[model samples]
Target chain A: MAKYRQIREDLRALIESGEYGPRALLPSLTDLTARYRVARNTATQALKELEQEGLIQSEGGRGWIVRPRPRPRRHGIDRYSRSTWAAGKAILIAETASQGMVARQQIRELAEVEAPEVVAVRLGIPVGTTVWVRRRTTFIEDRAHQLADSYYPLDLVEGTAIRQVDTGPGGGFARLEESGERLDEINEELAARMPTSREAIDLSLPPGTPVVELIRTTYDISGRAVEVMWSIIAGDMSSFSYRFKIPD
Target chain B: MAKYRQIREDLRALIESGEYGPRALLPSLTDLTARYRVARNTATQALKELEQEGLIQSEGGRGWIVRPRPRPRRHGIDRYSRSTWAAGKAILIAETASQGMVARQQIRELAEVEAPEVVAVRLGIPVGTTVWVRRRTTFIEDRAHQLADSYYPLDLVEGTAIRQVDTGPGGGFARLEESGERLDEINEELAARMPTSREAIDLSLPPGTPVVELIRTTYDISGRAVEVMWSIIAGDMSSFSYRFKIPD
Candidate 1:
């Protein structure tokens, strides 16, 4: 790698590893030159690039300091309280990036429990009825990215092969397809709010990072709302992109 | 409107107008009931709904408080050194949205002359060219929702019909199209970031709000980049959905 690129990567690594945090000042040009064994001009070049990228800032007398970044937040509609399989699937999607950070393995449990109030209303089921809950978290690059808790009704996944999605080759959707359940439509709602203190620590956010809230419900071929999933994304670190087709 | 809904609207109006800032506690249910001549239930209902919608929150025993929203900060990209028309267009966009509280209006003349180093490199323009800068704030239901800043090249809009996009029937793209410039495509690069204190105030964001940053560039039929627009949206106050056809 070129000298400047190497310096850039090193600096980035230091940031990701938390050696330098937001507002933390970096070494002076002369110090960087001696440490990196590069010319002062090259050090200047690397620092300039970093500043342009909005990763750092320079204060006249204070030199360079890190620009604060929002912690990673999850994005998706709220979780459904219908299937253990769907619950597991939702957790995977939420934690896919973050778990790699903390090196936590994904969970694949398949079981049933009572439905929560929000999920009950969406599923058109009683709030206290049996529902399956599948939970999981992703550890990306050894850092925890997200935590997902999903719920689903028990009738939907019982006596079917839909319970094995968490550990399945293609995951929950694949298992549902194999069970002859024709998945069809989806509805999604999104919002943003502050995370609980526990959530902030888990997502590794600055004290006040907000979480993007998304709740999604999927219907089957019969238009029956079969599954629901909710997710929380660290607001600063993530974005959700979807292409909506405008029907002709 | 129902009594509860009426109360909700009044409070919402006050909040949107900056009568109540983030973390500012609202009147107690008794106080609101006496002021609005509504039952305590109605007052509680109004506050509950707001909390559910993520607009306000109960500070435990301290009563409900306004949530802070994000403010926008402008970053200059290019200066229109010689464009008469471009300058007019920039002013139009800023002027139209400037009056209404809910209307998006923000203008930031990049301090290229003041901080040439940070402004020039981020914009990727020549060091000395003059760039007109504009910033915007979006609101949904009286909450500060998004923040954005744009930079325009001086030459493209200097004498062209496209400069009138802000007030006329067609936006910039339509104006360009009417002028016989075939706009073939638009490319957007998006990211999320934490807001600075200045940005938070301008966006009116509460602590922990994250912003969606977007850089959009329009290309003419011949594939030359014609215009660039940048936007920043508060994670909670706004959500963007776009539709694209799948290529065969």
Candidate 2:
């Protein structure tokens, strides 16, 4: 395992140091295994690590190739501006326009279910209380890049459009506002880890790929918990930027 | 590979479902390989993946043991609050205290050097301009948890403690303030990926361990860039919380 990591380091340094430009093609897995005199799995793991870094990709039948595309920064202030959504936009996919990639959204399901243990705690509701749950997937360039499950207190959405398959322009955020649950604050918590098998299957992530799990809690202007969202963001392609003033 | 993942998922579900509690011992790697009828490397990989998730740990001669400690949320807003460090504290260490862990810091190096391309761009300085570079590593319970490199323009820190091995009580932030750079805002750009070999070594991370890389840009009250910090936070152990209000 140590040997595998060492080989990956050497190749990564070469690629990132500009010795190999955008068109650089990496050595085949077979070539690496033979050169390093290690098992094929060793070399494959090394390549998989780079693929998880967004440093290389398998070009059809060809071997691994470098990609020079820039990863877009999801700016917190700009992306979350009330104006961005009030103008009728999907919050997460709005920034994708600059990446020159087509973003496709699929509303997997809209259902009313008893809140799970985790969701209940975040939404300040009883574990068995019914809540409006929306599960959605986002695809960029035909590749699933994000998966989200958002839970809203049933009381806040019982007669609102938020319970439907499509919440229309601006999605749920706008709907919540029109219903008097004007969002006052959003708290986002982030962590990273190896993707679970279920997540790996859902995102079609490569081996060794990690996912950024973001738990977001939204509160109404009166500080009432309105919605709690859990999202798995593709680690290799997603980045977040936040601007905040340091409190005295 | 599929077999390995299948085994991992099954065992993970069992643990999470409370079939095995915090102190339960996992089957040995050899036992897993034999039971699953797979290559030893495949079994090792599966176990390594779990270790990266902070679910289990190798207890030396005792083999792998389960850990059920809740991952503590690292409140980003409070950590950067002036009141946190004003009382003579390291902001990051302060948050770790809530986890009941002791943070030991090592001042790796304090030097003046020409800024790297990335640092230069963030600092709004020439590529080869001199800067005060401070690299430090933080450990919790003998395990490295965070690695950070902070850079400041030489002109701003030439006569401050920020260029010393230990920047007194509040570290560089205090020194920056003492030098007339009253920090008013900070911007953190976050991304996740498998750790580079150097980062893995610095943090003593396991295979498949992904790190949350935060690039923080600090600006003074006058909106002039004062410092740019790059930090690699331990993936499974640390979580960041950000609280922001939607503007009218």
The two-chain DockQ for each candidate, comma-separated, is: 0.10, 0.64
lDDT digits (tens) for residues B143-192 of candidate 1? 66556555555555555543432434434544555566665555554555
Candidate 2 scores an iRMS of: 2.7
Q: Which segments of candidate 2 are over 4 A away from where they belong? A: A1-23, A29-70, A73-75, A98-100, B1-9, B12-23, B29-70
Write candidate 2's Cα lDDT for A152-208 as tens digits. 988788888888877889888898998877788988888887776678889988655
lDDT of 1 by residue, A31-119 (tens): 88888899987787677656534567778887988877634433322222224235454434444443332234465355686778877
Cα lDDT of model 2 by residue, B1-248, tens digit: 49988877877997777897987999987788889999988887777667756567778888887765535446467777787776678786787786677778888888888999878998898899988889999887778888988999889888787877778887788778877778899998888877766788888876557888989999999988899988898786677878888754
- Compute the DockQ of candidate 2: 0.64
Best by TM-score: 2
Least well predicted 10-residue stretch by lDDT in candidate 2 chain B: B67-76
| lDDT at A6, model 1 | 76
Off by over 4 Å in 1: A1-105, A108-111, A117-130, A153-155, A160-165, A184-189, A204-206, A219-224, A243-248, B1-134, B139-144, B150-161, B180-192, B214-228, B239-248
lDDT of each: 0.57, 0.80
